[model samples]
Target: MFYKEIFSFIAIAITLAAFIPYIREIFRGTIRPHIFSWVIWGVTTLLIFVAQLEDHGGVGTWPIGVSASITIFIAYLAFIKRADVTITCGDWLFFIAALLSLPLWYWTSDPLWAVILLTAIDVAGFGPTVRKAYQFPYSESLLFFALFTLRNVLVMLALENLTLTTLLFPAVMLVLCILMMAMIAYRRRVLFA
Candidate 1:
């Protein structure tokens, strides 16, 4: 019980560690976050956190809850700073798909389906940021993604319940973060080469 709580807090701390600098970069105009991606991520993340709590995830959901707010704030910052506000048709597709998850989740009356749908939408949400990172490898902070990956791992470890509902979101996010990090590194190398 105590260990789970500690791990949960540590994960939250890591989230802060990762996001504070990322936010600073945004303010400094060093990192250009895609508005659509952050908005989708924010909405999905908050919903996923609710699903986790419904599944008795307990303390593990804390980091995700914190991330949700930060993600939304980043989206707001992107909009205000006029960073990557380009609304591609595909971006609209991703956003709409993400919004649909909520109604689908409500209709199903199952947190699992919600997590699954939201996770898929969240994955799709990565498309714009992934494209941006591929085009301008220098615009993202790889370390932020790395820390986020680590934070997800910690979140998984801190989970009180080991059910799929509690585990799926962080598990998938962990994989996604790793893949994103890998793609960013490869893009940086290929672009500079």
Candidate 2:
């Protein structure tokens, strides 16, 4: 148990370390290299593997990894190529905020509080990105929002102890889906009109 715990902690640390510099560049208004971004994401996927292998939550890991990998790849293809739409200061702020919540997630004994806090941070952090994605639907930025919403929903459901706040996460996800669909419809009408 001790070794597994330590390894889990180390894996988390490595992921965060790889993520920090990319995040710093986002603050400086520079997009990370697609390859570098992929590395970070790959590491994250691996983290999920370790988490599950250690029995932290095995079945849930696969969906999270698949969603994240697809989202990252699509996001890279869509936005990383455009200099003007590269990572911005707001993006970094949100990224860091989300990452900061992970330690809290690991440490908290109360699963309900952890879920609530993590869900809130994720949604809030992703808000700016989601707005930007909506404005530029053709860009890969849109993929992350979809993935983010999915991830939140899946994680909430995966929790063994279903809490009241878990319901809130899915409700929020439903609203996001509705809002995104509405935005797409509005944009299409505007363009065609």
What lDDT does each candidate get? 0.89, 0.47
Instruction: Pull out the clashing pairs in model 2.
Output: none
User: lDDT tens string, model 1, 1-193?
Assistant: 8999999999999999999999999999999999888988998899899998998999999999999999999989998998886667877877777776657766668888889988888898898888888888888999998999999999999999898898998989889889989998999889779
The top-ranked prediction according to lDDT is 1
Candidate 2 RMSD to the real structure: 10.4
Model 2 agreement with the true structure over 111-133: per-residue lDDT tens digits: 45554565565455445545554
Off by over 4 Å in 1: none
Best by TM-score: 1
What's the true lDDT of residue 151 in model 1? Answer: 96
TM-score of model number 1: 0.96
Give the per-residue Cα lDDT of candidate 1 at 111: 88
lDDT of 1: 0.89
RMSDs, each prediction? 1.1, 10.4
TM-score of each: 0.96, 0.48
